[model samples]
Target: MVMGFREFCDYEWFSFTMENYVVHILFSKSEPGPLLEGKSKYVELGGVYSAQLHQAHTSVGQTHIHVYARNNQLFAMNHDGSAHDRSHGSQIPNKVAQAITQKFPNFTLPKDNYIESAPSGIVNAFGHQLLLG
Candidate 1:
């Protein structure tokens, strides 16, 4: 079922923040209906393992529309930076921290050179970096 922008945001906010789920937002500058060829596109993409369809909306006075999907894969990456072949060692790197903050304005990393220490198996998901210690 398709949902509106407000509903989508509400669901996303609740799921990501309150429920600790990952949400992937796909935005389009055009109507998503035609582009998606109706709901069947979801199945064609990757079945249930793929990102779940959340909503598609066009701006009130504009032609742009956006599609939102959710999944948990974003946090599945190994925190050792092994996925990228670089060991961050206890603290998040300055450059990496900066990029995270830039992508998510609401997020703030410690101003100090490094964070105290993160817990094991921390993952960066849903545009938010999870530093569990």
Candidate 2:
């Protein structure tokens, strides 16, 4: 997909970057419903997405979306806490990563740790525990 150059983050202004390719952008409950329902090609246009990326839902959950791109790398955005909290030990993350690696062996992770926004009711991501903010 072709994307126009724009200012991203604080100091990164990029027109096009091969190194900045996104494998996926996972979403939670608050995502636009049509995109999750496959009514639109927005999610699939530039990357792959899964509405059922996770098998379980948290107490305060909404729909979860996963965006997968050309590489094994993936990211989570717009996800709520309860949904992510419930899916913690479901082998989803590792499984997803494995699948991506199987297909894109050359894909590299941009960071040693994955970054996800705090959920609506969470302030931190703990081991199988998301503390409410």
lDDT of each: 0.31, 0.36
List runs of model 1 lying over 4 Å from the truth.
Answer: 1-89, 117-133
What's the distance in Å from true for residue 102, model 2? 30
What residue pairs are clashing in model 1?
119-132
Model 2 RMSD in angstroms: 16.4
**Worst-scoring 10-residue span by lDDT in model 1:** 60-69
On TM-score, the leading prediction is: 2
**Lowest lDDT 10-mer window, candidate 2?**
81-90
Predicted candidate 2 versus true structure: per-residue lDDT over 83-120, tens digit per residue:
24323322234544454345434433222224334443
Candidate 1 residue 52 C-alpha distance from true site, Å: 16
Model 2 steric clash total: 8
